[model samples]
Target: MRFDQELIASMVAPNSRVLDIGCGDGSLIGHLSQEKGCDAQGLELDMKAVTQSVAHGLPVMHGDADAMLADYPDDTFDYVVLQRTLQAVEHPRDVLRHMLRIGRSALVSFPNFGHWRLRWHLLRTGRMPMTSVWPTPWYETANIHPCTIYDFFALCEEDGYEVCRWMVVNGNRQSRLAGCSPHLANLFGEQGLFLLRRRTR
Candidate 1:
């Protein structure tokens, strides 16, 4: 099956053991296992997704991301990925800490709320702007923290981690522009992917 979750796909290391937080249907993990030679496991909350993952012969557990990571031994894998789970989560900071503690690196992504179109929608139309990547109605969107890309960086700084790589894809990477044009860029190119490593004294 084809997949579009670039945020997850870009950071996963070939032949490394991986634990995907909120790994819906195990699509990315399956690809990593087959194509990249990685050993993959998934942590998913949806039972349907868990079933689908199992049927595909991928290892998965039916559990919450915030709750499940606590049980794993510290730094147990090459990567502990939290793709698009930060916004939907109730405690983003604590969740991030645990993710950092449990793995050498992390792959994290979220819809950037500070995109120009979202700004325009709020400034002119006074509503949460829904785009292709984030096609949620204002009331129905699961993005509790609807944060900007900068906000994410600031959090990483505060938590003593740093973004090692970043890629912004608006359907394609060829369309990306220089920093924060607010007019020339695609807002729906809303996804931000980063590889993070924790800093130590």
Candidate 2:
């Protein structure tokens, strides 16, 4: 399993329901089912991924995150996961709102746009930086709303979402950075993972 997947799995409660949006090949969902004994399902926009996941005996369906989430009733799941797909979604804020409404909590992960390496690369090259997490050229990349860890935290605060837990990890080093300071983590970490829930009034 990927390090992020392992981290995400650790946060989930055993035997709880999970819905993975934008799940690629259903690997996380499969792992969660086998290791955590959770009733996990997935929704993928790519039909090819959906087919491959179903062939592997995983419960995955073809759907778009932006459109399909609205159909689910309130509190239909224990956890809704949107790993590494936040920047690619059409409307990230709306999707997050729907996810929190449909599930008790949401797990979101995304590449950190404010990493020092990326900043340095852009500063030096005067163009979009392509790192391991973001390998494609600017035009070919799916990320339309790349954001820093600080940006994400601000968004959560503005929307009144409670951040239950969050971590910033160096994918290459396989080390987790201190998340107490978003500025420091955003400058060092390559990726970020967050567990969030709607704040009660």
Candidate 3:
């Protein structure tokens, strides 16, 4: 599992039902089912990844997050997870709405576009920044809506979603700024992970 997947797995309760969106190769799904005792399933757009996961005896289906998420009835799973796929989705807000509607909570992780390194690189080179995380060139990348930590918070607020928990991590090391304000996290964090729920009246 990737670093974000580990953190997401830690957040999910044992024996809960989970739906992992864009679940590449079903690594997290396997981990969640075998280790956490959760009923984990996955939806992936890549046919090759779907085949690989199915070959491993994992319950993963080929599906698109933007189109297929709305087909599920409300609260069908305990959790809906979208790891590192938010920016690539066509309608991120709609995807998030569907996710929260179909599950008790949502787990989201994405690269932070407001990281200082990116800012510095853009300022220094006056071109699209390339790093280990955002390595793809602008013309070739699927990330149409790169966003910051503060931007995510604003979106959650606008949609009446409660941020249950959030953290910032770089590589394998968790940033101390995760406990601090979003300003700090936005400036320093490489990626942001958030656990969110609908704001109940």
Candidate No. with top lDDT? 3
Worst 10 residues of 2 by lDDT: 171-180
Residue 132's lDDT within candidate 3 is 92
| Each model's backbone clash number | 0, 0, 0
Ranking by lDDT: 3, 2, 1
All candidates in order of TM-score, best leading = 3, 2, 1
The better-scoring model by lDDT among 2 and 3 is 3
The candidate scoring highest on TM-score is 3
Instruction: Name the candidate, 2 or 3, with the larger TM-score value.
Output: 3
Candidate 1 wrong stretches, greater than 4 Å:
1-7, 172-175, 178-189
Cα-lDDT of candidate 3: 0.95
Measured by C-alpha RMSD in angstroms, how accurate is candidate 3?
A: 0.9
The regions of model 3 sitting more than 4 angstroms off are: none
Clashing pairs in 1: none
**Model 3 over residues 39-98: C-alpha lDDT tens digits?**
999999999999999999999999999999999999999999999999999999999999
lDDT of 1 by residue, 2-121 (tens): 233654665676899888899987888888888889887899999999999899899999998767788988988888877777898878888888888888888887767777778887
Q: Residue 199 of candidate 2: its Cα lDDT?
A: 98
Please tell me which model should have the higher TM-score, number 1 or number 3. Answer: 3
Q: Model 2: how far is 42 from its true place, Å?
A: 0.2
